[model samples]
Target chain A: MKNALFVLHNSADTRSSEFATLAAIATSIGNAGYSSDLLILDTTGSSSVNVKHGSAFRNVTAVAPDKAVGDGADYLVHIVGKAASAAVSLVVGFGTISNRNWAPQVAASFSAEFVTACELIEVADNALRVTGPVMGAMVQKTLSLGDRNAVVLYSGENLAAPEGTDIVVEVSREPAEQGAVRFVASEALPDSGGIPLRGASKVISGGLGIGSGEKWRLIEEFAAKVNAAVGASRAAVEMGWVPSSRQVGFSGQKVSPDVYVAVGISGAVHHLAGIGGAKKIVAINKDPEASIFKIADVGIVGDYEQIVAAAMRKL
Target chain B: MDIVVLIKKVPDPNLPEQFVSISDAQDEVVLHASSQYSINLYDLNAVEAAIGLKESAGATVTVVTADDASADQYLRRALAMGADNAIRVELDDKSRRDSFKTAQALVSALKQKSIPSLVIAGRQSSDEDAGYVPYLVAHGLGIPALAPIVSIKSASERTINVGKLADASIDEYELTLPAMLLVSNEINKPRTPGLKGVMAAKKATIEVVASEPGGVAGVPSKYSPKKGQRAIEATKFIEGSDEDKAAALLAALDK
Candidate 1:
């Protein structure tokens, strides 16, 4: 029988989407005839007896963090928690296996520690493969682990379970630890009137082709109308047309939105790298040969000023 | 204060078309003759951060890498960009390094010398895109680490205040000395090597250290395209006037 171990984060809110998704994934693996084992990494050092009984999975088992290492399994799926510190600890815990033959998959927020663990595991064991910072939708569509010995998939925050999947697992606790670095206090900076771009479902970005800082209103108008976050390319940021916080590129935020709209963006490889996880990319550039069009699902070779305005009017 | 920055040499990812698939499994990519290799983009930012610190706070910046002699070229570039010294951790052909192994090698090398008060590295290497070495190094050294940092707000003799960008918000941290910071590209603009700096780099000596064998080497790569993967082709092009194309794009966005 196939054995799959689901390593979930012991979240504070049992009804959180993160927990529900993990439960669904565990249930799906069990239904697939794989003898699934659930190991919830408790960062808060909470008791697991209550958690195991309260979980939706039948015969749920809580594996201690220390003992969780080197648990022989055909598959290891890490459901990333919100706390980067907890995720890092869990990743380091499981990553201690020098040469374990287990396909590990992680779904997380693409934290530095988690990504490093995935890289280290892949480098340490050829048999183990890691895929993700995978989105929840992708996980739902491709949940089958099949016969892989070791797979690592990283699911991000706020994931929903697949259709018809029941999410009935809840555990009460505080949020996991942030990391080794201590947080001093939250400083409120001057408002830039920009939304967080990392996890936004839809993003409307402008590039260097937009020309001037004043011209960014075109992007702002488009974003406002579409109810999407505003993003800028590295060039645009460099040119001072937008804040560096709003830049979406390798040097900036890595985003994987459902719909990424690029206006006058030439689609530099650096820009494309940040958007690799984007589901559907729409490019609007006058240059047909622009690299952005190569990856764009739909291409529109035109002037952004006219096209975007026209598109705004239609919307 | 003494600072050490971790850097890497990676094939210019911008030239993806020039990447040759060597294995039938399509697991490996070799650079074409025309393709050039450069310092990992984020590492360059780390180097810039270190140099900026060195200039502002009076510190010596030493750059380290766990790569072969061929990396000297990039190391020289670091020197030109303002690093005081460079070290190359030599490895045997069979000795492959995952992030842990790489960190182990760097740690071993660092142990042979005076441990720096501050360690800096890119958030992640562009090629591996793992972003693990900094944390692993910090963990191995039993030091504190902060990552995805936007800027070093203030630096004193024993403490440094910095900004960290989370998914939705920016958080601040005041880390003591002897900490590791993995910087993002937003930290600072990396300066290009000027003529004088380039000339100075040519004369700079790169210190070489050999890494012990069996330092956690097994996985061949962090990323491998599944078999039968091809370049994406744009399925539809809204061909018409601006109004028609805009309308089509809007329609597609709705779908």
Candidate 2:
């Protein structure tokens, strides 16, 4: 029988939705005839192991931070939290096993490593699929991992269960202090205007099609309306229209925001590399043949200035 | 103080897609003869960050890479950009080195030479997009690693103050010497190599060292040509005046 292991932090809130999500995933795996193991990490220094078997999980094991799990599991799932540092440490510690499929948190610092190590299939709002290599490009292909080991990183929110499956597993633990306080600062530093593009959930970027540096204000104006970080293409940066720090491409920052809006930007492979992790892409360009349209969830073939301005107003 | 910067050479990703082709086995990508190759952009920023330290604190910056003879040009470019020295850890096939293997090779090279007070590398390489080498190197050397650093606020003999960008806020860290830092492009703008510096670089000799054996193999390639419908077939092309188009786009965005 196939086995799935889930690693999650013990939350103090008994009604935590994350626990529900875990139960749902466990139930789905059980319904599919796979055994589920839950490895819970307690921040309160408790070494007690609580075994809970319900409609979903077969066993729940509480483990210490230093304890290690045995290999040969068919799947590994890591539930990530808001603290990226904490999430990354867990991934590095337990997500080891080269060439295995792992679906880490979409925006985690180590997400790129997972992408490089695994065969990424499709990225959705609540889940992502990773499987063995595909032979040729096929349309509407559904990936099924018969027996290969797969790793999925999820936050335990917005999960969808299989049909006719009811999850009713309850597990609770104390919430430990959040954030990985690994490094201590000497003193508080002043903030600069450096764009926080790394963690931005929404990004609005522009390209040379905006014409001049002055006209780039449209991007900023639109970004301000949506509270998004501003980004630029290499062409704009090379033209001295924007700082290189704002450049988003293979040569610049790699961003995986939830929503990426590209205005007047013709998508190049370099530019697409930076936005590969973006959940939803919206492109606005005058050229219908612009490469950005190929990957965009929604494409608008029109004047970016007018469309962005109107969209900003509507928002 | 001694600072070491790690850099990599990659196919200029800005090249048109037509200039690049994937192998039939879907295991490799071949660049056309006309395709140009250059330093990874983030690695360039790392070089700049090291140079900035040298300018402010009189640190000696040495740039290193695990590449072939073709990497000498980029090493010279780093020299022209203000690195004090360059070392290329010559490998038979650089593509075979994964993050673990690359870190092992780099650590081996460092053990053979002087250990610097600080090591700097780009957060990740654009080609593989794996931000693992820095942390792996740090772990291998038993040192602290701070990554995705946006800025280095200040530096002293013992510690360096820096800012790390997290999900929503900037976290500050004071790292002791003998640490590793993976910098993002927001750290600083890389200076261009001037003509005089370029001339000097052309004349300078790059030290070459052989990489150690038994490096870990790279992840197996699983890329296949995408065969799905790239664009939505029923995409509605709104045709109207700028105002009408703007209204249409707003509605679409709302949807």
Candidate 3:
């Protein structure tokens, strides 16, 4: 059985939800056919209190006992507070500066044993799946391997199987697959709370040639008009016009919104990965060639900015 | 002191006309590297930061990339921009892999040289967006780690003062010698390599290799959106005068 090392921002007593999320995530890992070990760091005061074995954290694969350096499994994860923590040699930083992602903490604590690897899959700008048949992709994905512990991404609404999968389907933002995944097993946590999406909507959606950040004002105007929220294509966000929070793509937010509108947005599969299953999709790109038009029951092929203005006028 | 800065070659996260099926079909990738925004932004900045540090502290800077032959071009730019050397960790594997093992291989390489006092890296790479390497190296090396450092003040041979751009406030810390820092856009402004540097970067030598055994991370699944069905009715843009337009917009959205 593979092991997951979870790192936490504070001890369980402090960040209860984080612990809960870890348990739930651990449960998901178990469901996916993997085991987990948790690590929690309590920087409540100057004195660093490290809990180890089963005493401080029950079932933790390997918790840091008195600022112990590295001794963990294959996967290290940091949870709660974007700060990076290490129980093992593996290091990871996620979630918000305050509410970190659940997996990195575990990965960090188990850094030593777990050899982490990274892969780039083929997916649309808005979605995170590599192109290929689902079955073949599933087989390829399953057949393919990474170092002992690795973080992988895919698009669609499935985790490939009912059990025995050691991957996670995180619906949050995915930045460059570079040094952004921070880890620190030795000392002070990798204080990394560069949350490009906090306080913003849980999921944002945008579309089409949001070519320039200034032009994004048009999309933002529409988003403001609807108050529904904003998400963008790999196109607009790349143009550097919109906030990464508002980006929607295979590499961005996977949103399940109360309301979603595909304004001036094309429904590319990559883009679809980020906005698939929106309650309501309203496409308004000018290009009838825009794929979003196909997915949009409410397709409008005209100048998006003008149409948005018109729509705004009507609203 | 020698500083090793690691960068990644990733696809631009932004593709204008993208489709999920695009990733599904190999023949369908819309764009290539240098086209992706974040990879260039972060990678370039990493190179520039290395140069800046070398200039400020009288250190030699080397850049390493776990990328392909094509990225040799990107790394060469680093050398042109004043990086002493560029090492490319080329892998034969084309199948999707994870970041952990790649970093492991990189750490091994860095160890051959003097262990860097401070390793600088981008906060995250654009292609994978997994965001977890610099921390792993720091952990593996058993050193202190600082990320998102926006400001820095070298205090002495033993300690360095830095500022962390926290969510709400500025968090300051005095880092002791030999620490690893994961930089975000928050750090010092990263400069662009000049045409001269870019031309020079093209000729640098990089190393590539066969990746070791990485296991199946798992087949990722798609997410199901919970949004309701959109109206099948014809979409009519609410319109009127400027005031009417604003009113209509507000009325339609009811925000």
Candidate 1 regions exceeding 4 Å error are A1-21, A28-129, A132-180, A187-201, A211-214, A231-259, A266-281, A291-297, A310-315, B24-27, B93-97, B219-236, B251-255
Please provide, for model 3 over B155-228, each residue's C-alpha lDDT reduced to its tens digit, 9 standing for 90 to 100. Answer: 34455666554433445556666776656554554666688877766765665544452532333323221223
- In model 2 chain A, which range of ten residues has the least summed lDDT? A132-141
Per-model fnat list: 0.35, 0.18, 0.06
Residue-wise C-alpha lDDT for candidate 3, range A1-315, written one tens digit per residue: 444445554432233333443444445544333445554443343344333222222243222323221211111222222323232222222233322122332344344222112112322322222221121111122212223343322223312222222222112221211122222322222211222222232223555455555666666565554544556676665455543434564445455453455665656555665555455555555576776665554445555566566666565
- The models' CA-based lDDT, in order, is 0.61, 0.60, 0.47
Report the C-alpha lDDT of model 2 over B145-178, residue by residue, as the tens digit: 6656778888988888887753233556666778
Which is the leading candidate under lDDT?
Answer: 1
- Candidate 1, residue A227: how far the Cα is off, in Å: 0.5
Estimate how well candidate 3 is docked, as a DockQ score: 0.14
Q: Scored by Cα lDDT, where does model 3 land?
A: 0.47
> What would the per-residue lDDT of candidate 1 be over residues B3-115, giving only the tens digit for each residue?
99998887664555435334454334445677777788888889999999989988999999889987898899999999999999985433433555677788899988877
Candidate 1 positional error at B63, Å: 1.2
Best prediction by TM-score: 1
TM-score head-to-head 1 vs 3, winner: 1
Expressed as tens digits, the lDDT of each residue in A92-141 for candidate 1 is 22221210111111322222223322211221121222443211101111
